[model samples]
Target: MPVPNRPVRGVAAGVPFLAVPPTRRLDQPAPVVVAWHPMDPPRTEAAFAAALPLDGLEAWRIYLGLPLCGSRSPAGGDEELMRLGYEDAVMNLQGPIAVQGAEEFPAALGALRGQLDLGDGPLALVGGSMGSAVVLLVLTEADRADDIAAAVLVSPMAQLRPAVDATGRRYGMTYPWGPASLAVARRLDFVARVDEIVRHGQPAVRLIVGARDDPDGFLAPGQRLVAGLADRYDDPARADLVVVADMAHALAEEPGVEPAPQTAPAAAVDRHAVHWLRRHLGGTAAPGLGAAGEEP
Candidate 1:
C-alpha cells in the first residue's frame, strides 16, 4: 500500500471533530486520546474506536509519524532511534526530516492537554508503535496523566529511538532538562524505571503487538513492553498478543480498509480495544477496570 504524503483523514461514519475541543472534564466529562503513528493506523485505530462506545467522553485521535525503521519506505518497517517518546514533536517524515528524532512528545501532549484546557478531566491515551512508548512515559515516568482516569495502548515499544545529540534537533526542547533526563536514563535504563511506575500508577490497558511484525530494531523493544505489561496484567497472553493467523509487520494489505465491529480476529481485537477504552474513559455502558476480558 502506498502511503499518502499526508496522514489520511476521515471521520469514522458518526465520529466528528469537536469544535470546542475540550481537553479536560467539564460536566461529567470523559476525554480520551486515540494516538497513531505514520505508516500505521489501520493496525490499531479502527478497532479501538469500535471496541469503545462514545456515550460520554469526547474521544480524539493523535495522528503522527513515528520513526521505527531506517527505511521509512512506507513498507511497514519501524526502526531508528530518537523516536524515544513517539510524537510530542516528532513522527515519520517523507523526505529530509524522515530520519530526524525528537523528545518531549509525551510532555508536549500533556501540556497540550492543559493548553486545550483539557487539564484535570478524566484523561486516557491509546497509542500505537512508538506512540505506545510515549503513553508510558507520560503516564508513568513523566506522569502527565495523574489526573487521568485510565490509559489504553495497542502495540507499544520501549526506548526504541536512538540517542540524540545533547542539544537534540528540536531547538531548546532539551536545552537543560531533556538532555539530562535522556543521559541519566541511558545510564540507569529508563525502561526499568517506567516499569515500576506502571505497577503502581495502576492504569488498566489492553496492549497488543504482532509476533511476525518484527522490524529487528522494533522487535526487542516491543517485546520489552509486552513483558512489562504482562507483569502488570494477569492474563498476559490475552492482554498482550492478539495474534491472527500468519500476520505480517503491517496488519493488512491496506490502510483504512477494514470495517468496524466485525467477527474476524483482527476486527474483534480492534473492537475489543475500542470497547475497553470507552469503558476505561467512562461511557453509558462502561465497565470498570479489571474487566477487560468480558465480551464486547
Candidate 2:
C-alpha cells in the first residue's frame, strides 16, 4: 500500500498527524495494533519503548503520536518530525493539547481502517498518557469502538484537572491548565465511558501505572478502569492492573539518572500485556509468561 503526505483533518485544525505503517504479505488475516503514543514531540520513541515486546504479534502496527509529536512513514520506518514550535510547551504542560487528537479520532480511525483493511482481523489499542486518554475516548465515541479486542493503557489520564492539580502538589507551583476541556470530560463521563466499552462486550484491558506516577493522574484512572470492568467478565481476564512501585510516567530516563527498582516493571508490564493480547486475539498460548508476569 502506498502512503501519501495527505492528512485527514477534522474539527480540530491541528493535532498530531496519524501514521499507518506498511503491511507485510501474510497467508492468514493480519492482526493490527493501533497504538497512540504519549503526548509530546517525538511521540514515537517514548510510547514505543513503553509498549515493547509484543511477544506474538505478527501483524501491521499503526502508531498515532498525539498532536504535535509528528508522524512516521508507512514503510515501517522512522522520520524526524519537523521542529514545530508548540511541541515543547504542550509537552511540559498538562492541558488540552491532546484534546484535538481525541476529537479527531473518527477521521484518524477511518483513514487507518481504509489503509490497513482492518476488517481482516482483530484490533488492539495501546496508549500512554495523552495517548491513553485518546484511546478511551475513541473506544467510547467511535461507532466501531466496541470492535477493539483488547487494550493496554500506560499511565492513562481520565481527568486533566486532577492531573494538573497533582502536578502542582509535586512541583509546589500553580498551573491551572487541564487535560481536555472540562465540559468535554464531563460530557464523555470518563468512568462511565470505560464501563460503556465493557458493556458493549469488548475483551479485558491491561493497565500499567507507576505507583509513584503522581503528576500524570494515572493511578486514579488505573484504579477506576479495574473497578469499572470488574462485573463485566466472569473470568475477569480483561481487567489486568500492574502497579510499578516508585516508577514515574516518563518512558525513558535521563542520561546518568539511575533507574529505580520499580522501573524494571515496565518491560514486565509490556510482556504481561502482550501475553494477554495474544491469548485474546487467538495466539497459541500465553507468550513466555503468565498474565501479570506472575510466577507459577
Cα RMSDs of all predictions?
11.4, 7.5
The true-structure Cα RMSD of candidate 1 reads: 11.4
Where does candidate 2 stray beyond 4 Å?
Answer: 1-27, 40-42, 45-55, 71-97, 113-119, 177-181, 187-189, 233-235, 254-265, 284-296
Single out the weakest 10-residue window by summed lDDT for candidate 2: 254-263
lDDT of each: 0.43, 0.57
How many residue pairs clash (N, CA or C atoms closer than 3 angstroms) in each of the candidate models, in the order given?
Answer: 21, 3
Candidate 1 lDDT by residue in tens digits, 1-296: 22122223333222211112323323543354545432343433433233322322344443333334322233433333234334333222311122221244454454445433443445565555444555555565443445545555544444534212211343334423355344443432324654554554456555554555553434455456556766765544423434433434343344422324433444544555656665566552333423434545
Candidate 2: C-alpha RMSD to true structure equals 7.5
* Per-residue lDDT value at 111 in model 2: 68
Q: List the residue pairs that clash in candidate 2.
A: 16-67, 204-238, 205-238
Shift of residue 212 alpha carbon in model 1, Å: 3.1
Winning candidate number (lDDT):
2
- Runs in model 1 with CA error above 4 Å? 1-27, 38-58, 62-120, 159-191, 215-241, 252-266, 283-293
